[model samples]
Target: MTTSTPAPTEAGLDLVTRLNAYLEDVAATLGIRGESCSVDLTGPVAARMRLNWRLPGFPERDVDLMWHEEHGWSAAVATHSGDGHHVVVAYLGGRTVASQPRLVARFADSLRAGEHQDCWPGPPMLRTAGGPSALAKELAAWA
Candidate 1:
């Protein structure tokens, strides 16, 4: 007899749901206001959560929270650049999500304690930046 395995997307959906909730709380704690946050779990490679916010004078910005299957989670700020013609995605932070609940809790704790900022990055972004973020360093140290 042969058995079937569950789709990775099934897991992705559950994780995305929990992550969206976490992001909502994180935004509230940070005092970020505007449209509520939501995660798009339509694809396999990446799940994207987005929220809109505006400062008094500057234009509204879209904050994107992305989860990459292999690379884990990160945040990005999307907005029109100074040239006023181009939109840009400013990289923020990332961390692995091997243990969904554990990682989510860790992120919540860190954010609550001001230990991990949204500007932190995971390994891939660390390589791009030629260095690691504080959270990444901490994660590595413990590993």
Candidate 2:
């Protein structure tokens, strides 16, 4: 017998849609062309985006951004080991998990300008109490 994966619930689909739109807004705020960025929402409560943005000294490395229901947004770089791993480099450090797109854009700009703070070698601990449902509700206000 074969078992198939469960389909996403309507709530989960709505959350993904909102998250995708938010990432698009962030790209617009940063003046990044659509082709230079990509967002992934395959997971139930997490999302990831990749920007064709390179730091001044590391022109070959692309910037990776991720958001979780609990941890919000964090920036990272793909590890050099070719093992499909990323190293967390900076956290948005905001009070809420779902911050305004403009604020997230500012965080990206800071990273580009080499002035970012809140650097950590690993992903930070949970920063928000609300889970996916709460995040979906918060994003609903953005509509």
Top candidate when judged by TM-score against the true structure: 2
| lDDT over C-alpha atoms for residue 8 of model 1 | 40
TM-score of 2: 0.74
* Candidate number with greatest lDDT: 2
TM-score of 1: 0.36
Which runs of model 1 end up more than 4 angstroms from their true locations?
A: 1-13, 33-35, 44-86, 97-143
lDDT string, candidate 1, 81-140, tens digits: 633132323223344433243454355444334454443443343222111232233233
Candidate 2 regions off by >4 Å?
A: 1-6, 33-44, 118-132
Query: In model 1, where is the ten-residue run with the lowest total lDDT?
Result: 126-135
Evaluate model 2: give its lDDT. Answer: 0.66
For 1-143, candidate 2 gives per-residue lDDT tens digits of: 01122366877567656666666776677676545444444443565567767766667666677776667788878777777577777888666667788888878788889987544445555555454456667677554
